[model samples]
Target: LWGEACATLETSVGPNNFNHWIKPLRLTGLESGIAHFVSPTRFISDWVNRHFAKDIIGVLSRPGQPVERLRFDVVPQAAPGRARSAASGSAASVRPVASAAAPATTRALRADLGAPLDPRYTFGNFVVGKPNELAHAAARRVAEGGPVGFNPLFLYGGVGLGKTHLMHAIAHDYQMRHPAAQVLYLSAEQFMYRFVQALRESTIMDFKGMFRNVNMLMVDDVQFIAGKDSTQEEFFHTFNALVDQGKQIVISADRAPAEIKGLEERIKSRLSCGLIVDLHPTTYELRLGILQSKTEGFRAQQPDLQIGTGVLEFLAHRITTNVRVLEGALQRLFAHASLLRREITLEVAQECLADILRTNDRKISIDDIQRKVAEHYNIRLADMVGPKRARNIARPRQIAMYLSKQLTSRSLPEIGRRFGGRDHTTIMHGIRKIEELLSEDKAIAEDVAMLKRLLEA
Candidate 1:
């Protein structure tokens, strides 16, 4: 009964978890087909009892096995090592059998380690716009594998710009094509927590063994480990181990590795080994495409709900930060419409997302507009805040001042107070100049359009 239950669990739960949690367990004795075992620690015992005990019982009870109950004894860790052969009569012979299953068990363990990759995040579902075309190509290449051309593919972008989506897509592609390859995906925080826990428990080797053995490892938001010295050192070593073995490593962050403040130079350089793909902010067309894609997905779940082209355009234009927020807005609208048993309309969307949409629209201030515009143009931060009359910096600075007056409800004198205490007439002149340039210059017209998009974003 004990052997049958072990075999059933081995096949069902994969070998890695079985080895880590189950293999070490000593089947002490059997009574009335009810097997009792000794686990090394209380944590492991409790975990097994919680998640796998029922399955264990189900497996044991199959074929009319008379297993009625299973029990565990948490013995002294040192004592179990010494008494293994005495406690389990066939332990010496069991060593080779357990050794034979170790590799297969480890393979099974890797299969269950991380969150399942989302099917929707595959390359086919990724919509490429100018903003993300380069990043998309780099990801495709990484997914194709071999020679890694990019050893550590570092993908960075703002929230919801598909950093995680691309990472999942790459993992999905790799696993689908190479079933035997081991892949692990986790957030940096999870990595840090696991490392710290392993260190504290004197199981650092076990942590390293788990991570370093994988054929491919992906850590998202690597920036989260920037300032933690111990975690970074441990990760740095794990990264080197995998890289030296010619294993593939992928990392994602909100910014370029170099720009990740407080990260060690060695870690930064290691990250730079592979291609760094920065997904730029989404363009309007990209936003619209994302909306259409999300709408199609929503339609799949709610086939009866109808959405109009004009409503999609409105949503796309209004919620322009990134794909996540856009999808969130659509989800809110869908929930509201479905609950109310009404068709989705622009008015309904506005009502359903009124608080978010209104707050987003109202939150722009003159200072916000000026700082954002100046940053977008790459003018000196001082030039934006200081008095500058030269055409190069002055022109962008004035445009920023003009945008502040146009976008925010601040009065002219109030706006002046925010921008180097200039007179209200200076604000007026800047607005007039920008207005005149917008009418005559195509370049200025484009700049205005670009600025509007950035400010709104």
Candidate 2:
């Protein structure tokens, strides 16, 4: 009767779901007018009790074999060949694979999740700044594998904003703690490729079984599967099955799920159901810190080379677009200086990164900023530099001044001359006022940030 009921349950939830979530469950036999089941861990037991308890009860109750209800318990004796890891309090290791090639079985699974780990992208190496602190914190929580941590951890941002890096860090750290746990980390493109391969070879059951049974599943650049309907459908079901089983899932994308066009509404809601964190573009201070950390590593290798003062500062100030670009510029600077035996001066930086500087060069002028700010605030362009001390016009003028100071390399006196012949001190004061308001006022900060992105874009 028990075997009959399990077969019925497997049909209801599909093959992959049953293999991953239901198969691990052990029926300890019916007792006290109620059926008792055993699970490997507390998470699995609780999940089954909440989601499938009633259905399982209905299935087990037969004409002769009457059962009142169902109950689940965590008993280590029921699970075999599993041992807990010291790194993670609740995690246990799985069976070891003999080789890297576990194709359609556990062989390919070893190679797929094993070699992609980047030792450099750990929590220790990741620098936390205002732009990325929230994303970092959320990633850390998910990595901890706490029961209360939100599922379907969604991280999205523009290029080089550390979205992929954070995702990789989570995988690396989680694997370290849960050495026995199955952590499948890959890009969405790879996911689609493997899915198609399974379909072509009629081995989808193997694919589904392997993917569905993992402890942690991470898909990077999930936006790639947006317009691909078949892949999205498969991923949607896989996602629902995992979430229903109380497993931890992590995803990364270039943009928010809702902003991604051609994606299913159901998938969007599922992705958004959990915590969503966005990493803002790198700031000046963050850029400097990153350069500092990178240069410290370089200094150990080349002790004879000298880095001139203001070199890193200039690079940080000039290269404001992406961290990847910034790191590349630093590498180029060090290589150029070492090969030529020249100090890493601002001139050397300029010469080595001339192409990048030209590409990311800010083209917005004082007038351009004034026009944009006026247009954004619905104010008169003439009033931007006009002698109107009214709050409405004066605030817009100050925002323009602040933008000119930030988005351009113009000096205070030069920017002041553009604004009705005001002194440089007045320009500095206005810039300071906006800077203070940036911390105090959320609306102003968002407006300024949005305007900057538009102008910069």
Best by lDDT: 2
Candidate 2 per-residue lDDT over residues 226-309, each given as its tens digit: 899999999998899899998899998999999999899999999999999999888778889999988888988998878999
lDDT of 2: 0.78
For residues 61-114, what per-residue lDDT tens digits would candidate 1 score against the true structure?
Answer: 746566777676543244223323222335432332233323543433333344
* Each prediction's TM-score versus the true structure: 0.66, 0.68
The runs of at least 3 residues in candidate 1 whose Cα sits more than 4 Å from the true structure, single-residue gaps closed, are 1-100, 103-113, 370-441
Model 2: ten consecutive residues of lowest lDDT: 91-100
* Candidate 2: segments with Cα more than 4 A from true spot: 1-104, 113-115, 362-368, 375-378, 385-402, 409-457
Error of 1 at 423 (Å): 19
User: What are the clashing pairs of model 2?
Assistant: 93-180, 94-180, 101-107, 102-107, 102-108, 103-108
- CA lDDT scores, all candidates in order: 0.75, 0.78
